[model samples]
Target: MTANVLTIAGTDPSGGAGIQADIKAMSALGAYACSVVTAVVAQNTCGVRSFQALSPDFVADQIDAVLDDVRIDAVKIGMISNAGIAEAVADRLRHHGAGNIVLDPVMVAKSGHALLDPEAVSAVREALVPLARVITPNLPEAAVLLGREDDWTVQAMQAALPDLLALGSDYVLLKGGHLEGEHSTDLLTGPKGTRALKAPRIATTNDHGTGCTLSSAIAALLPHHDMPEAVARAKAYLHAALAESDALDVGQGHGPVHHFHALWGSGV
Candidate 1:
């Protein structure tokens, strides 16, 4: 069967992040990509200038249009900017009973712009978080979910495993890239066990779409493998993208990872 991956996210006009990155990442991994935009973000690698979120009904209509026709193998969700949209997503996906869902809790942008509304945070936690098969949250996002400060280290992430596991997700991948270190380590905890996945940190400013890429890659790989295996494979793919990222100059600020590194050849 042909694999298909569906992404629900906001638009990044610059094409370095959000729905753009999600599509690129999934398609690069040999999955047919489909998307439903929940918001339109006027942003770049530098920062988010502003954004306009679509109505919850519009978002649901898009979801229904896609789900009504295509048989999606997996779904990658990111950048739900409000509570109404979050609840809509949760309700509809449950109605369809979509499995192999990967949710990236995108609270803030790499450029320090807040992508999610504070009031909507509760809605996502209450409605969407539990429906996800895998929840991928960065340190700061995890902190926001836990109602704490954004200060996180590998130790801190490990210590917070119990709290994350309690959020009803069968698996949680706490990203450790924001921590100052020589390695980018991600802690993946699940109902089965815990794993510390480590990859050498690629030294480059081109890391704008990393979170979206990783989660989309996970979604693309999930139909073929288990959650842990899918995550590990996705990490390996992300490592290659990051390591070979220096070639693309998409913007003046933090650039995007090289999605076609294997085919185009790396500049580094």
Candidate 2:
């Protein structure tokens, strides 16, 4: 049976991140995609200019409308612009008993723009993190969540696992993409133990929406695969997309990964 994956996030008019990237990744992975907009963001491959967050009640209404009708197999939550929206998303998902929740703590964008409010950090850590089956946070985000400095080495990342897991997620995917290495490694820790998942660091300027794509892809896959398997497959998918990202001419500063790289014919 096909899985229904819902993405609760903001917009990326450039179609490289947020709701646009989530839908593309889910569809590319053969899952039905659904979405609820939490913010309308003006951003492209380069960076975010400005954004307007939706009212918390309206965000909750959107969640209710979707959960009431569709059987959401999994949910990938991205940018909740403020504390109210963060609480609203958590409340609605818990109310619906949503499964396979993948939370990507998107604190700052790749271009150095802040996507989440400072006040929302606590709400996400308290309300949303506990509900996630897997929470994917980059080094900076992990540091913020733990109220400590960013991990600069693998050993430091390993040392932070217990605290990350204590944040309430069943599993924590601590991303090490910011580190200087030939292979991008991420530590996945849970009931079994910590395991490093590595992929060749494709040196390309097209890294937009990587977090959104990976988390959403996992959400799309979780209905059929176990946590470990789903994460491995999602990382592989993102790697391939990154490897082929240069094939397209999207923007000058940064470009989006080729989400349909495997499916689309040549010369797109």
Candidate 3:
């Protein structure tokens, strides 16, 4: 039987990010993808134009409709949008005793549009992040969570992992793509220890949905592998996607990483 993976996030009409990207990544990794949309986002590869959020009650209804029947093995969360949606998602996940939750704190879009509301950041940090087995935060998202906009060195990311773990997640994966370097590094920290994973930075502008892709890939692989292995494989999958990111020409702005890189003959 195929494992079920759920995404509680907004929708991207452009199919480059949010629920669209999450489902593509999950399905590519052999998981049944399910979704509860928090917002209907009007965006293309260029950038997000605007978004309309669903009612908190409706978001809960969508979550309930799925969790009540499906045996979701893992969940990848993104684009909480507001405090109400944040609290509602947390409530439902906790109610179901959901396992292998991968939280990607998607605060900003690749085009520099704000996906997370400024005020709701606190609600998500306090209410939702704790339930996640692992949290994947890019450098900017980590800075927003930590309230520090300082330059994030590889060492800074390593030190920040434990600090982020204090937010109640069992593990934290701080992605180091935004930092200038030869390799795109990620630090995974947990009770066991901290390990640094790196991949040569593929030069491409088509990285719009990298975070969503990575987190969903992790959730898709979690049922078959241990936590550290899942994260490592997900990072590799993302790196391959980035390597072939130029395959898709969707919009004028930052394009999307090819989620079907393997199927499309990436040979990675």
Candidate 4:
């Protein structure tokens, strides 16, 4: 059976992140992609200049339209710009009993511009985190979510994982790329316990949409019903993407990972 995945996120004109990246990642991984745009961003590899948020009602309508027609196997949520949109999405998903919702708490861009409003962080915690099957937060994002300093080490990340789990997600995949490590390690914690995914960090500037891609990849694999397996596969997929990105040049600044790397046989 074909698995249909929905991504509720912002639109990135650069196509490196947000709904565009989610769609590409899901489709590349052999799943059909559907999207509900929560915001429209004027962004590029350089950074985000500005963004326009969609109305909450319209966002809800998009969700309803997709869910009414398709057998959505999983959902991946990205940059929700405000509390209202977050609340609307949470309400709709809860009402529909949406399963396998992967929430990627996108706070700042790769260039350090804040994508999510500072005040909206609380809304995401109250409204969306509880409904998510898994929450994927990078080191900086995890620090923001935990209300701690950004200089968290691997031990600190491990210590904070439980608090993230306490926020009501079935699982939390704490991405450790921002930590100063030779190998990027992502810690996945859930009802089954903790599993660590370790991979050699590919030295490349083309890592713009990594968080979006990884979470969407997880969403694509969720129909198989093994969260740990899905996370492992997604990490492998991400590694391949980074490795394949060596040849392609999408932008002058930090470019996007080659998501179609597997199709071209360039990925490991």
Candidate 5:
């Protein structure tokens, strides 16, 4: 049976992140991808110029349209730009009793453009975080959620995972890519314990949509009903996509990872 995955996020015209990347990642992982556009961003590989958020009612309508027909097994949420939209999405998910929600706390773009409003952070934490099966936050997003200024090392990242889990998420995956290191380390913590995922950092500026891709991949694998195993496999897939990014050229600025690297045999 085909796993059906849904992504609620903004539309990135560059196809590097947001709903575009989530859909690509889900499809590449052998899942049917469905989407709800929360915002429309005028962005490219370089940066985000401007964005217009969709109405909360419209966002809910889109989600409802999909869930009413499709047997959505998993959901990936990203780039909810405001508090109202976040609340609406949360309420709809609750009403539908959605399962296996993977949240990518996308605060800013790789080019340092703020993708989420500072005022909306609290709304996301209070309304949406609790509903998530796994909350995936990169270093900057984690720092923002925790309200810390200092850089997060691997030890600090591991230590903070529990506090994130305490926010009501069943699991937390703290991505260590933003931390300066030779190898990228992602820590997954849950009711059991911490699972450290290590992969050699590819020295390239082509990681445009990694967080979105990773979270969606996890969601795609979650319908199998194995959280830890899904996370492990998703991490491996993301690492390979990054490794195979050397040959492809999408933009003059930071490009996207090869989402189909596995099929091309360019990744391990």
Candidate 6:
């Protein structure tokens, strides 16, 4: 059976991140993709210029409309810019009994623009984090959620496990992409225990929408694979995308990963 994956996120006109990237990743992985937009963002591969969020009630309505009709096998959530939207998403997901939910704590953009409101951080931490099957947060995002300084090493990430687990999610995938090293590692911890999923740091400047791609890939794979396997596979897919990102020249500042690297063949 084809798995149906829904993405609740904002827009990226550049098609490298947010709803665009989510749909691409899900479809690339052979899952049926659905979307509910939370915001309309004006951004290119370079950076975010501006964004206007939708009303919380309308966001909830969109969720309801989709869940009422479609059998969503899994969901990937990103870029909830405010507290009201966060609460609305959480409430609607709970109301629908949504499963295999993958939450990517999207706080900042690649150009260092703040995508999430300061106040919404707490709302997502409290309302959304607890409901996710797996929450994928980068170092800075994890630090903000925990109200602490960003971690710099694998040991620090390991040390923060107790608190990260306290967020109440079934699994926490703490990404170490910001850490300076030859290998980028992510720590996944849950009832089964903690383990590191590492991948070679691809030498590429076109890494736009990496978080969205990874989380959506996992959500797409969740229906058929276990948490660990899904995450591992997602990491591999992102790595390949990044490795092949230089094939296209989308923008001047930063380019997008080749989401169809395998399907489209080389020289894309």
Clashes of each: 0, 0, 0, 0, 0, 0
Q: Would you estimate the TM-scores of all the predictions?
A: 0.98, 0.98, 0.97, 0.97, 0.96, 0.99
Q: Look at candidate 2 and give me any clashing residue pairs.
A: none
How close to the true structure is residue 163 of candidate 1, measured as C-alpha lDDT? 96
Report, for every candidate in turn, its global Cα lDDT versus the true structure.
0.91, 0.94, 0.90, 0.91, 0.90, 0.94
Give me the runs in candidate 4 sitting further than 4 Å from their true place.
none
Q: Model 1 over residues 116-230: C-alpha lDDT tens digits? A: 9999999988898898999999988999899988887778899998898798888999999888878889999997889999998888989989999999999999999999999
lDDT of 2: 0.94
- The sequence of per-residue lDDT tens digits that candidate 3 reaches over residues 1-268 is 7889999898988898899999999999999999999999999888889999899999999999999999999999999889999999999888989989999998888878888889999998999889999999989899989898768888788778777999999999998888998888899998899898989988888888889999999999998899999999999988888888877777888888899988977544
Q: What is the lDDT of residue 233 in candidate 2?
A: 99
lDDT of each residue in 168-232, candidate 5, tens digit only: 99999988887777888889899899888888888888888999999999999999858889999
Which ten-residue region of model 3 has the weakest summed lDDT?
259-268
lDDT for 230 in candidate 2 is: 98
Model 4 lDDT tens row, 1-268: 8899999999889888888899999989999999999999998887888999999999999999988888899999999988889999998898888999999999888888888888999999989999888999998888888898889887888899899999999999999998777898899999988988899989999998999999999999999759998999998998999888876768788898988887876524
lDDT of 3 at 44: 88
- State, as a TM-score between 0 and 1, how close model 6 is to the true structure: 0.99
lDDT of 6 at 38: 98
After superposing candidate 6 on the true structure, give the runs of residues whose Cα lies further than 4 Å from its correct spot. Answer: none
Per-residue lDDT of model 6, residues 4-66, tens digit only:
999999999999999999999999999999999999999998899999999999999999999
lDDT of 2 by residue, 89-146 (tens): 9999989999899999998989889989998899999999999999999999999999
